[model samples]
Target: MPNPQLGATSLLTLLIFPDVKPDNILVDWELDEQGNQTVKEVALGDFDLSLKLIDNQPLRAPHAVGNVMWRSPEGQSGKGVAKPSDVFSFGLVCIYGLGGGDMLILDAATIKNLKDHGMPAEQEIVVRHFLYFGPLSQGLLNHVADETWHTLFTSAGSIAEEEAIDDPDARFERWPKDIAPHITPEAKDLIIKMTHLDPAERATIDEVLEHPWWSVGVHNG
Candidate 1:
């Protein structure tokens, strides 16, 4: 299915959306022995499945901030969940759902190598972020708080000579054109903004809802 159709359908079906990850969103379909088929959305618990309302503030799962979830650097560094974080994960889902699997910049072997060399799984995931979505801006780099920043930057620099296409803009320009042919330019633009490395720089859900891709007659009713 085209991502816009899937995204729009999801939004319409789930009145309150949270933790927008692929695993949380399911496709319900079945085929009978007589060849009849049925498909529908199945509700899984409450709208806030992975969230907890504490003192009226929501606390989301920390483990969700990784390869599949697409949290910003600050988020991974413990800034906690916000709407922008959800936007980042939603963009990841949209890109991967719309035939953009090959756009994932890291392969399993690289991840394994990092782990074998003593990088923690969480830090390894962050390193992959830098590899895929960096050379970080000076402002973003300065904002990075922990030792993970130094580790990620040093690892990125070490690979720079071997990785010719290190610029995020360069990679972004080539990504949808090559891997996700089904994605429109406007959709790509939305995804790029939504998945920005800085949470402050990422698009809000309201902005995403207003993006042209959602209203361009490309999605299903």
Candidate 2:
């Protein structure tokens, strides 16, 4: 049920889903009579973790959800979840789908290995972000309630140059290259915009919808 506290809703009304991985989202296609498919709609499910801000209050607290692979960097930190968390997760889902079911560093086997390492799985995922996206901002790092994470990054929120090692995976950097098929630059740019390491820097849901990638027309890929 929709929260009564939300009262009337408009295009600008904001709601946060603490978990927005692909598992919680569904897409439907408008099929033609000739047995062809056309994507027409997307539905968000599993509102058990859905969140709503009341009276302009900020959302803060531990999250309850699964699927560490798709969770946002900020959510993994102690900053609590926000709308950008959903954007980050959704951006990953888009990457997964667009890349033809492969995002090298984010594969299940890697996440399982991290889970088995007896540390927070997000720690390694954060490392991948640092390597690929440059660095986490101090403003973003300040939200981390855990002091241990401080040792892994520099004062500028970047991995130390001497200790840094690139993943060399078939991800954003390899898009439209030999590792990836003919994915468009517009597509790559949109995902980067949505998945900025700093939650505050992530594109809003509206901005993502308005991205030029959507204008390129859908391809089966």
Candidate 3:
């Protein structure tokens, strides 16, 4: 028997693309002799808003960068972005990919309407986020620190739903019809973990890539 040698260990570099959407992801597909399509390689691009953190701490920016419709709570807050920010954005990208672009935490049309009506879409988006990922925890709301959210939600982590705005036409209509039953448990777990409302609670991007969903072959179950 031959002995196996240990190679150099890969170091963890906390990098944040801050913006991860379907448009930024590049995938190269290959077809085998049997005409089976396989993923040759996958790459991330549009690093104009990308950042590499020296430590695991959040990277604060002057203004809100990244795609508006696909930004993480922290990133959009104009405060800072961390590994969990990337996890949340990429998690949404995964949802969009799996659902064939059907899942959107905040749709552009809704945002446009809110802006047109002199309403901060952040409030509505918060409402949609609560519907999609569950209510915003006190820790998350405190971190984001949006004025409207702080006013609408109490320090006890309860939101005043009566005062919140909503998109009557598309308030999570796709959740039950396009998600839930269609997504695998492993995938759902990973995505939910990645998209945890609290950055402190969400898994790091490293943990996301190393999740069992990628290794267990339980995606169909």
Candidate 4:
């Protein structure tokens, strides 16, 4: 039986529209060699048992050059980590979870190699990011810190100055085709909004929650 605490009142509700609450959103955990478990919830605010309510705040952290796949373009380019960066990571998670994992630029074999061996060269990761996101716009590129811009474009050979042209339409057009036959149109729209190349243009968490994709299976009954 589905747990009512998980936000579904009945089997029908579980099949239709299931609420995703922060109480159920596991942030991190550690498993001991003895099979002990330590879990950490992403609790930013109060959790009221009386109402089963959670007031969550956007999690923030200083940007770090690790986990190339989950890092946003701005993060890779040395921008400070913020809520929008989390949105980008969430988009990647959605893509992977929605049977579009193969759409990413990094192949399974390469990923396995990296995991078994060690971190791939930074330049290799940058190249993969370029292949995944295409070229960045000139305005966005200019906004990136000087050292990061120079490293990605000059040292890493991931981008060229001539490639920095604005073509927002192409960006949106390319992603859907890459992940087609698996993802719904609504999922694609939400992913695009969540993963906008420019952090300022990325959708907020509230917007993501309100997207039509979340309502696709909802029923009035």
Compute each candidate's TM-score over C-alphas. 0.63, 0.74, 0.74, 0.54
Question: How well is each residue in 90-182 modelled by candidate 2, as lDDT tens digits?
Answer: 777777666634542456667687678875556666665555555556655665544554555443244422234444342355444554454
Off by over 4 Å in 4: 1-66, 105-122, 150-172, 175-180, 217-221
Rank ordering of all candidates by lDDT, starting from the highest: 3, 2, 1, 4
lDDT of 1 by residue, 1-221 (tens): 22334345455332324455566666777888999755544433335534433453323344443433345555565434555556777777777767775554347776588678986555554554555555554545544534555566556544642353545433553453556767777777788788776666878777887788776723521
| lDDT of candidates 1 onward, in order | 0.56, 0.61, 0.62, 0.51
Q: Alpha carbon lDDT of residue 19, candidate 4? A: 20
In candidate 3, what residue range of length 10 has the lowest lDDT sum? 1-10
What lDDT score is found at residue 61 in candidate 1? 47
Q: How many backbone clashes does candidate 4 have?
A: 0
Which digits, one per residue and each the tens of the lDDT, describe model 3 over residues 1-221? 00101110132253567777888877777888999776656667777866677665677666665776677777666655776777788877876766625446556787788889997766554555555665567677767666754565442223423322343323233345445444566777888888777888998656876677776623363
Task: Name the weakest run of 10 consecutive residues (lDDT summed) in model 1.
Answer: 51-60
Most lDDT-accurate candidate: 3
- The residue pairs found clashing in candidate 3 are none
| Sliding window of 10 residues with minimal summed lDDT for model 4 | 12-21
